[model samples]
Target: MSRNLRTALIFGGFISLIGAAFYPIYFRPLTRLEEYKKEQAINRAGIVQEDVQPPGLKVWSDPFGRK
Candidate 1:
């Protein structure tokens, strides 16, 4: 192979490796959280009529309502 062709293949492979390593840590959690939220919404709908909190990290309301 030509020098440029070999360099390009190496760069592409390195990028693919980085993406593969990152996929589970980044994308998988997001997908799992989405699935969990969907399930929680369904379950909450069945059990509760009012005051249903969505499934996610709980954030306390600021007492002063600044945020």
Candidate 2:
């Protein structure tokens, strides 16, 4: 094989190996995290929740005289 072809083949093989190694380490965790976030959003949705926060603990809605 020619030198240029050999160099290209080596680079391509290296890239494929890196990508294969990365799939489980990086991509899988990211996908799992996205799935977990989706589950959390579903679980934390207001429509499904039963308990509500009291006025004193409510955020940004000051009923008392603060101003």
| TM-score for each model | 0.49, 0.45
- Among these predicted structures, which one has the highest TM-score? 1
Give lDDT for model 2.
0.69
lDDT of 1 by residue, 1-67 (tens): 9999999999999999999999986777566776755665676565543345566747434232346
Clashes of each: 0, 0
The lDDT of each candidate is 0.69, 0.69
Q: How far is candidate 1 from the true structure (C-alpha RMSD, Å)?
A: 9.4
Residue 22 error, candidate 1, Å: 0.2
lDDT of 2 by residue, 1-67 (tens): 9999999999999999999999986787566776655765686667522256555563433222257
lDDT at 3, model 2: 100
User: Lowest summed-lDDT stretch of 10 residues in model 2?
Assistant: 57-66
